[model samples]
Target: MFTYVMRFLFCLLTILPLSLYAAVGDHFYYADWYYEILSETDMTVANLGARSASTPGLVYPTVEHNNKVYTVIELRKESFSSSYTFKNVDFTNYAPSSYKIKKIGDDVFNGTAIDPNTIPPCIEEIGARNFADRNDITSVTLPSQLRILGSSCFQSCANLQSVKGNFHLKKIGDGAFFMCQKLKTVELSYSVEDIGNDAFVSCSALESLIMPSAKTLGTGAFQDCPKLTSISLPSNLVSIGESAFLYCTGLKSIVIPENVISIGKRAFEHCDKAEYILFKPATEPAYVNWKGEAANFTDCFNADIESKMYVPSRKTYEHGIEMISFEDKPLTYTGLSPEISWKNNTPWPITVDTSNLPKTAGEHNVTLTAAFQNPSISLNIPYTFNIVKAPLKVTVNNSERVYGSFDQNYSCSFEGFVNGESESTVKLDLSYVTEANYQSPVGTYPISATLTPANYEPEVISGTITITKAQSTLEIQNLDELSNLKTGEGVIICWISNAPHSELSLGSETTASVELQKMSTLTNGEEAIQYRLIPINPGEGKVGLYASGSHNHEDAYTEFEVKIEDKAGITNVHTDCVSLITRPYEAIIIGKADNAKARLYDINGRLIHNGIDNVIRVAKRGVYILIVNNSRYEVAL
Candidate 1:
């Protein structure tokens, strides 16, 4: 009840003074009444050696004998000299005597309450806009009782470096100390929640800043001050306004807490020197809509660092292996003269799993990471492991294509490449084991290619070889089925064409059987016909066609279906069986026997392919399959 009554009486007193002034037809003039008195008063008239006389009723109207100025009138014309006496305003008996006096201008007083020696007749407040536009004032000491520094109180005080005191301040008004250029270091006290736009802008020399209690950096607050280097932002700070640090170039690195949602454009513009902005790892997978994958910010930012040279340690000439992984076996290094320093940030002697590398032969690149106290200089040492085991290489010499026919012959070979400087060799060991429903070149074949340089490890430096039995196709042709002919009268059953190292032993009729021969007209698709006959006998009851065209261990075989027909079937075979005249294009059989030796010939009796064929390119247009020696196949081209 007492508190409410006191507050009511205080409100009435404030309204009564304002009402009385308004009713008297006077505009409410908010000015320093004490300042006006201090400005124009003569405190000591008796001590003056009067060079300039104060004319009565001219300079000021002295009323009531106290020398108080109720109004000002035009001064009577009098010449004033430099030696005229000046009076200092005396406030010896004032209510607040020991206020923390902050001198803003030559005679302007922007002060806060001091330890009062006496009780005040009225509530004393900081004068309205009292400290306005005082750029010359760099240092200030506020009173503990200071409640407010009104709007624009310290606006545009560019040199104002330090502001101290004022424990009770609740708000700092708008545009307060807008461009305090020399004001680099600021100690913001409690309860300052809101700072207006353009506050504390253009303080270029600011090097270090710590905003422990700041809630936000207002719009354009620190724009265009290029010399700022580091800032310690509060984790609880919510938002930093647009263009807040737009042109601050000396800053090197920064971290944006997850709490900050948006960073305005041009807010970090022209800040090219800054490298690697750290951010909290995303809890949810953050996908890049443009890249269609989870963004590897580390890789992307590192690439940017490399291209722009923003990070001092990202220079291109710096040599370092990136990352190496061990799989299947611990990677072994040979002839490493300088002791290899196990790198990466992991605890020393950490064993990484290496059970995924190819058991046979291949090349792989691995990566690892290490932490260093000095990141800039540590990049010169690789954070990855590099080792070159005996490089394993597998080569299919024309490894892409091969084929064979029943009662035919074929050949196949293998080769390899070395991936490092190791002197290991891979020797081929063959075995004759038939499985998987077919007879194949089965063996525990071990092959490898060792690097010759003994220490250098190239990325793709190994090659190897494996020879296997070729797959064969089936073709049956006879002259008796097409033309009316007798089997006893010599009906040329041209079977064997150019079976590399194959043979056929006639089964029951070895005396009168199909022979191995070369037909001349069948080579180039020429209509005119000729034949080169090579006598052959089907040995025993089965005509076994064996192929030995491949490497020494890659020989194979295929059996042809036997046909026993009457004499009338032989003449019909000429007309219906093999249409040599109608076969489109010509067939050229260019193939290798043992030791990779081969030959090529056209239907026009021309050698197009050599024994050691370096480059063989076949263009099969409208080519018929050439059933050569009832074994291999040559497409008519």
Candidate 2:
């Protein structure tokens, strides 16, 4: 009766649905002899061993009836533990046949003691070490929404033939499908730009490749892929990073599109079989060496040589191109009316006539040919002929013309050319208008010559002629004019231009040159002030102010009026140093009052000073009174 009751309880437990389990005791646990092999949950190990409790979600347990232990976990639960022993959980019915997978819950399966079986299709993202060495997976269709294939996802899956569409995949994570030797084919997404280094390194079966329009290729991307034959570089790529295609020995040729500006060193270095490395015509410097500098040789050509015109020496060729000049003298026609025809001397024919010739002078036409020595090519070059004649007599006409102070100068002449039969003449003319009134104007005038005759066309030539007014004279207008004169005043008055430098004069000191050194002025009741102009270069002659200096000075002084008198009778006579004014020198004193009185007398009692010129004129200069006390000084010269 107890056996019957225990059997009934076992049957009832199998019929009732299981609930999610947590604690070991709460799981559906049974005694070692009470094991049952049921598929109520559609799992081969449904009741392989007795459990304490049932779980709601997927319950993947490694159940072995012999061990009477089961390790289970609820799919929806965050944590759970597995049992140590199980029994009767083996798929002995499909032993060594590779089929033990069973569905325990919706879209869930347990490798429950992972029995070489087809994993449920809903398993999109496989965890690490999931099926590392499992060779049963010959082909797996990864979930379409599966973008990341974790490391070692299908590593060492020796039987993996191909990866089913992983369409939304952007990256094949590090070592995701590593060492899957049977992975001979793959349809990578267009969006995968970077195939990490060594990611496809040993993919020996990969022969042809199509790189996406990625800007830079990672290192060793295709290293050791010996079967790779040819490649087409993308138009927008700037560089192929290090060893990108190293050891691709079978590559024959590559078309490096112009847009690919740089190819990293050793990128295709070991692609031994490649013969024709073609690149688009680079607009800028293209090839770069190991040190990242520009490569030199663009194009090269061979050379061939024949006799006279040899190609330049090799040394000349390397530095720069060479050039030559040929001089051909006139060829004489000694034969009677010879038709000068240059034959096979050149690739092209050339001819000239010497038939209508003169007895004394001969005419000749020379032909030159240029050849490309390298390719043995030549072409004819042509030039003209000339007949000799006696030298012509050339001469300048209109030799001279008298130019007025303000007039234009004109002259004309002709050259005589005599050929014994007809004589030709060439005329020359000098003609130009003055720029200003030459009483010599402030600047020079340009003289121009024009040539004309039957044979010569009109031509012109020119030169500059300075214009300036005459003498070196001073015209002191007033005492105020000399007020701003300082130490530099003497230096300024030393070099007075636009006048005769030799005839230069100032004050009453007449000499070749006059400089007012340490000079000062004094006025007595003012009609005019007197400044003694001392001579620095002198022969010692009578002194007087010339008209030029005063008129041309910065103040434009006109003249001065004064009276000369005897120095002995002059009051207020002062000079720290004697000879300062050439003592007893011609005195310069302004009119004391409106009608100032004045007189002049030599030490010998003769009056050589007078107001005759309104400018006190003295035969011999000596200290004398410039009397302004006399009547208003007027010219007494």
Candidate 3:
């Protein structure tokens, strides 16, 4: 038992050191060991094989024994890894003098040398013509200061899922990211100015893109991106290169801006899924070069992808005006034509038909027909012409006299005025009189008339006629008893006659006046005349009347004596005082009566007040009068 124990102890001692040495050496092959054992494990390590160790979450270079480098090969942490390795060396501290690459996670990488000076002499950009076929990277966050992405950068990176941090980038070189089948999202910066030829071509997983600041697009810029459903081109873009958007089948519609002057060959060809192409040029008759050929257009529109051309109509001549009169010349219209086309080819010649035009002077509508050689292709256009008319002139003959007791007839004449001169006489009709009344008493009457002329509307006119009464005898009676009149008093002289008088003349032999108070014809055909005789001064006067008729009726004359007296004790005077009856509130004295000492009394004969200065003011409403110098003057209020 003792001999077997000694042999087993010796063999165990030798194999234990060898196993520890092999375990330590496995960390030296960090990349191989990581893929073999810890590729799927979740852990963090700062320094794997270096002289000095780094902090737990910070990655930096540290020299250790033997001047060797180490990094984390595959860290499957929840947030981010601190350090990583490529080919078993740490490249987190690499500068432009010594360019290197390192993978920090499953498909994530970091690079330190990003500017142009850090790149090789033959390469114009940091990643130009490099890494075209790399398929392992799933996401890349580039440096913030990267200005340009060179030709074919990251092209054919089939597994590249996303790219971030291109904030200061200015241009994207030719074929950059071309055929990156798995690339899903890439946000370009606003500082970017141009997109080079074939950029982003065949990026089938890219759904939406925005290039807000780019002004020019090179040839085939977005060709063959079938999964690209939407793209926002810059508003200030000026031109598009050949085949720029070929085979972009996912686009629904597009509007070409007016600022873009040229579009290259096949730029929008094979875009079969696009429903419309809205080409908005700046002006009419725009010239567009398509497929190396030029075409003129007034407006470019395609509703459903079927090509249709619009050709504007041209006016040949202006329409003439026609005069309105019986002796006017016949009117003829000519020279109305329009250019017509279909599918960019002229198919017909236009002809205007004015045969159905009316002979009247007014606006007339004419029909224009685009009659082609083929009857199936025809269109109609409606046109118009203007016609004028001369004004009408009317004159009526005045009658010397017309008896009011008999019916009468009259007429008016009309003429057409041309160049301020009468051309021909126009016929007038009596039935066109709108208003005519001649049965009234003798007076002047107006006649309202309107007439219609050929090819014109109704014309209005005005006329007048004088009417006179028939011959009749005029006589006055019952005025011989108007003799006793008082000073400042009025007497009414009345008379009856068998004929109505149009006027009457009155005269006085003394300083007295007479005024006609009322004159009216009674219902029995007899006339009544009344005159108010005012005895202004105390004297005897004669009031005469001369009645005259409207026509040839004989006039009659009559006279009466008016003795105006100033009686000192005249009582029970009538209420016909001229000044007192006219102005009932004021008191007035007769001729040569001064310092009269008047007294006022109401209609009931009751004394109310006294007056001075031969003037009285009655304060209440009633019939009152004044008695001056024992003479009573009655006033009716």
Candidate 4:
């Protein structure tokens, strides 16, 4: 009773609150864009600012949402430069007037409560510090369409372990993952072109990096990263920023890309353990931010650390080219070396990248890098090649069509795509054709399934379509002859038709005078079925045969009369033709009766089915007579 009373009061309080003054719409700009719009579609939301209630409101007097009206409150104006405090309005359900959010503006999420975990695939850009200082977040898998990460977007995400899925990302803003101490791995998309200043600074746990398309490294981009054992730079890299690897002590060796034009001051200042440095370019690049004249090469590394350059006799170059078959596995560098230097006392190790190779057949380029622990040699090799598409298998599934059907209901399936691709990745033009038509006779016809392939060789696996004769007509041989049935006399009404609708049915009038018994299917398969009907009373009635049809067919029905006279036929006769039973699958015939010569005939006096042992079975409906010992007997089998 108390709970019900409280619930009633609560409902009353809720209803009266709608008239209260409240704010709505973009009152505080809590989100960079409306959360509902950002998470709902492939549309871009831009210029989303962090939530702020610092600016006083004086415009609205009313707001409507979900068909309920609320009075808006007015507040005194405040200075634009006034210090702001975090205060969010209940505008989660509010939609901005426009949905064209295209780019995340700078400093938009500096102090907001929004979580960046649900960034939709349609979102292409992220503003700086959007998720900075948010230690609660553990992982971030960016959308495939995201093109850029704003400066410090996820900086100080202490729990972040992996950052991936940004297949189209081109740039990483300054300090994007700065101080993210736990970040272990970074999977740079092949399209990434630049890494900004301090982008991954102080990411102490980072271990691996493979940037295949990167062109530049900004100042302090990877400063203080001690766990990065190796870095894969692309052939397109043009510059290395200052303090880039200042304290990357774990890097035992480094490779200067052949295209690098400049190296900032102290680029590898504290990389004391570095023993090898190889310059791939034939000419020395301008050592910007260094002393007036050319200092020792070790100046790029620790002052005490020795770094040597090797002149090339055995230079790195592209291998002989071959068009890759789509069916062939991704190419590996296990046996191929871009550079071999026997002059160096220590063995030079070459890294053949078999992993991250493109899976789909197409024209692609890869960077071949070789580095050594001593002499500090760096070599960058760029190789371009083509992958020829393999033959694709298209099978037109086997089908069955009605002999005269006009239904061009054809279907096909496709087989064979690479691990990273599917049929949807290619333009498929599938067409199916057969020589058979509606007037064609019943038989099998060949069907060809063809496709135009752009990335794959077209290999068609032909199929067949079988034209089956339709079961349009029903026949009961002696149906009209079943009008008269004696009291003890029974007839086996064989239900014959290609279409199996239902068992033989008796009309109300006939059903009242006769007892219908179920029987087995004859040797002719489903086309022949038998039913035994013995009259129990004298009356006139009707029997009906009905069938429902499928496509290109029509329903069928027929009616016949039946008359039963209340009199037994040879009920006292001690001789019978056969002791019969009706099992659905097969017939069970006992030994013949009386050991006499016997023959059976239809009502038209035609001979019954020809079988051994003088046995008679039902295959068609008719009046049957048994001539045994030249004596006559009538019964149903």
Candidate 5:
């Protein structure tokens, strides 16, 4: 009779609705419910009541039946109709093979346990561990009240693509979410503090991740995630576990924060695409076990040629002076004789083998050896030096010249040399050669010239030119007003001179030579001489006489005019206004009308002036005339 009653109670419990179960405290305690309800297959709705003071929310417990133990599958809320009809569950079923329970309104439902026949017999406890490895799951939404994820909770969910919730989670267990190949994005709760080993490993499609509050990363946590391009680590993180980012080829660069103190071996090993590792420390960190032997943090990059480490310190292993120069000249031995220095400031004997240094102007490498004073320890350092050509020198010579009576040509030359070798003469360039008006002045004047060589600065030289007045003098004599003469008549004139010989010319005729003859002294004890002047044509002109000698003697000149009467009959002669003025340097003549043929003469009958125009230019101031046709009009200038 007791067995029958117990069987009836069990059968009645299985058929009753899940909301009829009373809540214990605030959260629904699955263990306090009847065993028949926990073993039901269709109890799809459950109510967790209000949050518990001790457990906060719904609590999963281990249930013992017969000689077997069953673990809690999952606890979640459920929707309901107005009349209390069971509605759908709210939590996502990421693991389809695992059973789930729900809280409908305030009532809790204990759904069916997973089929024992389908689960492997070796797995004794089937709950979080089994749910994590289920094959049918594709997506999941973790409960917000969950604080810690047990180990292997989501391992090997190959098709799992997305995960949401976990707003209050603090820690993720080892092997959680491992090998979820299709999983792409994850948004971690801000309160998460730790990630265990192999978490998210081999999640090839997982591209984005954010763990702002996580302080610890376990070994192989993010390894083999090829599509994971970027992640933001917590600012307070201090250490990284081994193989944390192994084979994460999409990660390009990472910055180690200042508070980080150590990194495990192979933390970034096989990250082929990572190019930069920036450290905030000014010097090397204290504990870096990345590589076994050298154990530098950079070694985890697997000797990638493009990968580099940036340190803020200026410290280096080398100590020496570097030389540079624009001129390609040989370096002296005295300049490079200083002993080699070590960072520890150890005194060592040094020797530099500069004999192999090339003499040609260019950069060269030399060997330097440093030996300990005890002669047991020695080191060799390779040094580089540069040699360039030396500067050039240029010089120009000054010049001087004496003035001559006529224009003349003069030249000045310069010399230049580069590196003590004379340059080609063709490269010499001079600004100018001759000085202008060299024959006109009788005082000192400045003369200058510039010389330029191909590779040297230009040089300019200036000199003085000196000129002196001539010494010889001459004077004219005989009657003052010597005037008319017949066409073929000759007139006598005299002259005085102190030169060797005197030359005479009539108009543009060929010169006539006159030899100086000795005579008695005159008024000022000056030598006196005489000569004859003649007129051979019926025209007005002048006879000019000049005394010539060497440059040491001053030249002398004198002139006189003569007129010859015209025997031809007058043709177009007319009386017209005529004017003339004669200064010591020049004479001017003007006529009232144009196109009048005029001839001018001095006391001598030489035709000194002839012009067909109204104005005529003459040399000396004297008495002259304008003879048009056969009429003669006298004028004084």
Candidate 6:
């Protein structure tokens, strides 16, 4: 009977009477009542923006055809604000106060023109019917510290378009915001736990809701909310009251969480467009009304859904793949057990147990398991896996040597070894072979390398041995002390080059002439030539001997000076060099010219021994001696 009376009064107030109109607009304008009539205004004000209108609905539709001559523009209709009777009237400004409000008493401003926006944030609770039946407020912002929204607080507030909420709100009282048709969204904070009966009923423009922390939805809480297409029932919600979603028709799917053990009768009665309802629990939730009336889960659904409800299971497979340890890939188990490939035949997903799966590389027998709590079922299967060795490539690097030089120092390197393992662990038989020998002609020869391993597979890349033509050089020998030669005496200059069949040419000169003595070629790619240089004239000059290579690779050059004495001296003793038996380290000679004398000194030009009779005294052993007559002769004894 009380419920009927409240609904009856809610319909009756839509057409408010004169007595109620006088009471509804008793709101404060700044600090005074909004209904206080100022002096009647026959003269119209040009700038309405300057009007001191602080209270809502104080000057609604201030200038329009509804204005009457005798009727003063009362800022308040007093009943159901903005009932549209506005005439010109005067407004007065009042001094605003800084008073702090903590709570609003019940019916303090019920069915009156109180603005929800004007409620100070210091207030923590709003009394029932505080702003009910008011047409001026377009939105409701809950106070920051407010925890409870009293029943019917904003009910029948026809123009209420939205409701802003905060995390501190814990409950929405019954019939709060009822019949607010323009409210499109209900995104309350997660701290809200209870939605009282008829809390948002007949909110036709409501399309979505997100109060996932709510545990109980009261009777008729969301009844007749037709535009709502989706609603996420809180995971912690234990009960949904009767007719909670009675006439909502736009929903396409419904998911009942495992915590929900009971669904009230007619809770989802007219949601005919919903294609499926997936229940997470194994058995259907009891569909009985809270009054202890017996009912089935199918009884609440529309006729289009009674035959479509059914329970199903899923499918999965277990197997393993062949891999190698040398590939440097290691395996560890994540509890999800990726080995068992699943094929779920239902709308929901399931998890698998990997406790028996392998964590290291080897051949092992394992089992995979999957369990489904809803429509309870379990699957177990056996499988096997193996790890093998990886293949590798070893190569002997290319080698280079001269044509006549032998170099057997062949080197090698490896590729495709993983996990820090090298050739030391595996026995290897590696051989490098080529067709070229130490005496082979200059050319590039292919060297094929092979490797046979005991514990691993092997591949090879062939290399090459290049025989390069050696550098050729020429040098004129016995020319170091060939100075002051007499006209009748000559000295042999021995020349040699590393290239066979090589020839040496002398540049034109004035002081000397050369006679070819002998030429020879040896088996080791060496060429030799001997030239005897005889001093012809007294003037001294330089002569150049240049050699060209035989194998077309090497070239060489040499230079030396020759001098001839004008006077004829005693028969040639040893100015250049002589054997130990023929010319001893001490030589004695008497010249026809009494002025001819020879003096000997050590290698440092210090006088060691001397002879005045044209005799030269040199060291007895192989120490060097410089014999000075008209010129110095460096002789090694």
**Which 10 successive residues of model 5 have the least lDDT summed?**
317-326
Error of 2 at 522 (Å): 22
Residue-by-residue lDDT tens digits, candidate 6, 551-570? 23434544444333333221
- How accurate locally, in lDDT, is each candidate? 0.35, 0.38, 0.44, 0.53, 0.45, 0.53
lDDT string, candidate 5, 1-637, tens digits: 9999999999999999875543222223343332222433422223322232232222223444333444444333333322221122222222433433321112222222222123211221222343455566677766545566666676787777887636677778787788889999888878888888888889999998888778778888999999987666666677777788888889876655555666667787777776655454333444355342335544555665222554322232111121111123444322223232223222224333334445543466654443334323333444556544333333223333332234234455444343344444435555554343533333555566555444345545655544433222111122132222122221122212243343434332111211111221111111222222222344665645555512233345555453433432111122221111122232121111222233344223444344422222221233232122111123222
TM-score of each: 0.30, 0.31, 0.31, 0.39, 0.33, 0.38
Residue-level error in angstroms, candidate 6, position 287: 2.1
lDDT of 2: 0.38
Q: What ranges in model 5 sit over 4 Å off?
A: 1-130, 281-283, 286-294, 305-307, 314-637
Encode model 4's per-residue lDDT on 1-637: one tens digit a residue. Answer: 9999999999988888553433322232222211111211222111222224743211122334334433322111122432332224223233332122335455454555555654344557776776798877777888667788889998998898788746799999999999999998888888899999999999999998877888888889999999987887788888887778889988877767778877777888877666655556534565555332443345566655432333222224121111111122343222122222212233454343345555445667665444543444445444555566766678888998764467888877777765455667777787787888875655788999777766677778788998765432211243332333223323342323243533334322221223222211211122333333333334666645444412223255454454443322211122211112232222121111111223334333444432212222222332232212111112333
Candidate 1 ranges with C-alpha deviation above 4 Å: 1-130, 142-151, 165-173, 280-637
Minimum summed lDDT over a 10-residue window in model 2 is located at 299-308
Candidate 3 residue runs with Cα over 4 Å from true position: 1-91, 94-125, 280-637
**C-alpha lDDT (0 to 100) for residue 132 of candidate 1:** 50
Candidate 2 C-alpha RMSD relative to the actual structure:
23.0
Residue-level lDDT tens digits of model 3 in 111-181: 22222222222222343554566766677665555666767877887888776636677888898889998
Which regions in candidate 6 have their CA more than 4 angstroms from the true location?
Answer: 1-100, 281-284, 292-294, 303-342, 347-637
Q: Whole-model lDDT for model 6 versus the true structure?
A: 0.53
Steric clash pairs (candidate 3): 51-63, 51-64
Please give the distance, in angstroms, between residue 19's alpha carbon in candidate 4 and its true position after superposition: 24
* C-alpha lDDT (0 to 100) for residue 103 of candidate 3: 22
Q: Which stretches of candidate 2 lie over 4 Å from their true place?
A: 1-146, 156-168, 177-186, 213-220, 232-246, 254-270, 276-441, 445-543, 546-637
lDDT of each residue in 150-196, candidate 1, tens digit only = 44556566667766534455445454556666766665556455555
